[model samples]
Target chain A: MKKLLAAVLIAIFSISALTSCGQGLSRFSVTYTDVFDTVTVITAYAKSEAVFNKAANAAHDELLRLHKLYDIYNEYDGITNLATLNRLCGESAQPVGKDIEILIKSGLEYAALTDGKLNIAAGNLTCLWHDCIANGTGLPTDEALIKAKEHISYKSVKLENGTLSFDDPKIKLDVGATAKGYAAERAAAVLEENGISDYLINAGGNVVSKGKKPDGEWKIGIQDPAKQTGEYRFIVAVKDKSVVTSGSYERFFEYGGKRYSHIIDLEKLYPSDRYVSVTVLCGSSADGDALSTALFCMSVSDGKALLKQKNAEALWIYENGEYEKTDGFKIYE
Target chain B: MNKKTIADIILVCSVVLIAAVMLIVTTVNKKNGDKFEISVGGRVYGTYSLSEDRTVDVDGLCVVRVKDGAVYMESSTCKGGDCVKHKPISKSGESIICLPNSVVIRVLGETDADAVI
Candidate 1:
């Protein structure tokens, strides 16, 4: 009986020790659900009590600021400011905010990099589809699409000395594809400047983790695209990296028994049916965002080649539900 | 061992636990001494740091100034400048939101800063 009692006590102590060892970090999250249509932000950090509070407050402020900068529907926003200034046909220069300029430049660069697969100036095509969906009608006619396509050119949107102008009055700028990622990057910079070392920012599905957990690496779960909730695929342990995934599963409309993805193909002026989702890991949220969108528009073979060339990593899930990952992904079971 | 020995051990363990808790609390308070500020939607809100004097301009929106351990919204385009209505925030989780300009102000401590998600 004495020996059995001792064994039980020892077991209890060991279990307690194991649990206590991994339980020092405090977690706080602020959810801003209104922006990005239906997207939310969940920011977590590990720090002392006071530090945690301070960090959370700062992050909340940053998120609100980013929303104002990126809201496409907000007519007074800088993106709209550009649109209004360029409402008349022909090139007319308009001064833009630094943040807007960076986003525009990034959008054009990504467009060129992905062979025009990801174009912010493709707003004309996007708007037509948006209107169709809003009105509960079918896709726009081919003739209407062609007319819209004439104004959908990233090359025509010029940027110089913090001024942006468009050659076409119908040309609009949509940063929906990359704005969240850019915001995450900027928020991370704010935290770094304030001396917060270990944190994770999850803007919708895009995640950026900086520093490491007490045990070393940050463990993140990549949700299964098929499931509405719960972890489906695998967990990744990383340090100081950003992981962004773009998928049709998040937002879409079904018409005539067919599911149309939200991500539109600039050249075809229609929804893409290439891959189910694309996940990219990189050092910056902006890069991860751009690459994830671009990869979704490319074939598996081409995406693989591009990832290899860029020395970046990706996980591609095809329409058949089969998935392939680049060699750089260190997925943990 | 007798009950006396068990009681003594329990007492020691309890004392150690309390001490650890106190130590953590002290560490947290120490790190939180500095005040940080954040502005959202062109409204200034945050904890005023005694050591640093800083000013932020939202450009056609608002300006926030922190000086001598107090922070205030100095100028704003919004009606009534109601962001100035709130008291200066020095602790964590305090915030000021300017709805018109879509800006938010917050305070942060050193260790709890960087988050990417």
Candidate 2:
């Protein structure tokens, strides 16, 4: 009987030892450069590398699909992507995929919500800025900007019965502002569907978190726009939230020693300098992305109503280094 | 006590000790990240210790310099020069990316936050 008792104790100790070995969650990360014209990094805590890789790859595939669907520059074979819609929608109603339809509808919703402050139909104006930024050329001529601005109206693009058409031939759709955040949100959903609870998806300026880390909540650092470096101006802890920032510092052109931001102001027909950067934290990354851009174009007072409508919080960083955050945003900080 | 019972007690205590040591080691290692990884075109190019300062040429596309436990892009053969203009990054998880050249230099240690946006 004594021998039996000893044997059982040893077995119990061995089992405890084994269980303790696997107690803590392991951290895994992967990076992709081919999506959304920017670097995407996915980090998570999981039981094993194999498990994380399965979920990460699935999330990556989803992002790639969204990237191709929303692409405006490249046209894939047999894919009626956004570029195709932009080219042929004016000629006739183009058959659209569900993904494109949803994205367009979401873009329109944001356009309407912001009262046209976040217009995706300003593709003509945005494309001009994109070209100048890519080629390191000077800013677009005032005459050219004004001409493109003439066609900037959200009502011109029509989506009906999974078909997209343009009432105005000059009206084009550019979803650059919301595509990354929307993709990030979708990728996070894929991770959650794979049973991965603790993960963070950083798609360039858009960050979406699904759950808290083993140690505590996930921490996110807001970049200092004036520095344009990896330095953080503030660090916030959060869980199950999406944080998105829009800044003019990342992509810009220099002309006559003056920097021109990529975000254009609708009223000025020029890049807006209202704020150096605007960051929004909310439940959906897509909403955060749109609000960040809209807030960057408008003042804090003008954006308060919009923020309250979406149940989101914001932090606006000015060029002079002054900053302001909503009351709720301070909770995470 | 019987010899067999004494041996079982010793065995249980050693197993517990080993588990404790392992837990401590892993926790300590996770807390200290003093290295950075560099990648080009989404593939890892190399990893360098931040403690050992050195200069690395990234596929003849750019120059990366690690000095005083901080890493920065010395020069790049791409337009915009944003990577070069970026400040030296010493914190774990901080990265400097050159989009035109598809070069990324990211610190590869555990950080306070999972990511910086």
Candidate 3:
């Protein structure tokens, strides 16, 4: 009887382990590593392998499509399309795609929210910086920056009858700041529509996660700004949330033992020295990404208040290794 | 109650345990295989592969390369090798940055690949 009972117990344990298998989750990822940049898409599902492959393929295609549309190197992209059409026709409206329309609307909204700190019509400023950096020169002179600022007005870029056009020929549009977020959002929508409940999509620094991990919640780590390698500053438990981080450390130039990051201050036409990094959590990846950039350029108090107003959350890492969290963030201890 | 019966029971239990463990291990590896890494700038900012070579350019920042089972910041416009200090990233979910350049390097996990809108 004793032997029989042991056998029964073992059998039950084995069956339970099999039944509660958490490892059955299927995952897929595609990496596009190129000379200019790299983008990777990862998907986890309990559905068919074919379905996951199709979803990943679709997401990859969409990413490439957006890259073509927004890449500054491609002068024939949507921005140029609008610029040329506006110059030749003088505000004779041209029909735009839903995605572009949404982006323009969101861009205007963020510009208003940041009081013009997040202007998409600052293409002249972007071009000036690009030109200066390419020529191995520092930021343009104050007079030159002011001249460039003349074309950096979001209000001048008008939208009507499902069309977008710029009033000034000097005015240009660069969606580099927002295109990745929109692409990420679109990829997530594609996965969710295909019945992928458990997945995470990260385009550059913009990340969005949905559904629940088999263990119930997802674990995300915030990078340590001071650490060169092998340590995280914090770990946050997230679920169905999008996390986007913007930091000055990611890109910069050095001069006379000083580091100058690539994030330009539109007002100064120079790199900023505000917060080191800003992480935003919100419902949409695009919002999180855009807000992270905008908030990083603002004061800590102002950033927190902005997150509060948006009903979102943020964590700001300062230069001195100090950090601040918004009221909305339920940071893990 | 003899030695043969006891030995038979032990052998059967061992077989069952091994089979169960193997099933679990296979499933876990399958789930993990879906994850990949994207290295950017001179540092590995977000989640990405440490085993393969990857090159990325972050606009105003310098171009970064990850190759030959190591990660390093090859070049940057930043004053110091702040990004180079990050070395090469081998672990997932690790990152390096050149703050002055606005360049971010990250190592994302497999589950991190899902798109968030």
TM-score top scorer: 2
Residue-by-residue lDDT tens digits, candidate 3, B1-117: 555675468558856785977776566444323223333422234554556677766454676677875566778888756577566764444445454554555555533322321
Query: What ordering of candidates by TM-score runs from best to worst?
Result: 2, 3, 1
Query: Cα miss at B52, model 2 (Å)?
Result: 2.6
The DockQ of each candidate is 0.04, 0.38, 0.12
Per-residue alpha-carbon lDDT of model 1 for A227-247, expressed as tens digits? 533224667777888888788
Give the alpha carbon lDDT tens digit for every residue of A1-333 in model 3: 676667667767766665555566755544443212434446466566788877766766777666665565544633544345435433355667777788888898888888988888887787666665445466567887888888888887777767776777567776656777887888788877777888877676677788876645665657678865335577677788888877776555555677766567787677778878888888888888778878867788778777877778998888999988877777664
Ranking by lDDT: 2, 1, 3
lDDT of 2 by residue, A67-100 (tens): 9989999899978888888999888888888888
| lDDT: the better of candidates 1 and 3 | 1
Over the full model, what C-alpha lDDT does candidate 2 score relative to the true structure?
0.85
Give the number of the best model, judged by DockQ: 2
Task: Name the top lDDT candidate.
Answer: 2
Each model's number of backbone clashes?
16, 0, 46
CA deviation > 4 Å runs, candidate 1: A1-25, A46-50, A77-91, A133-136, B1-117
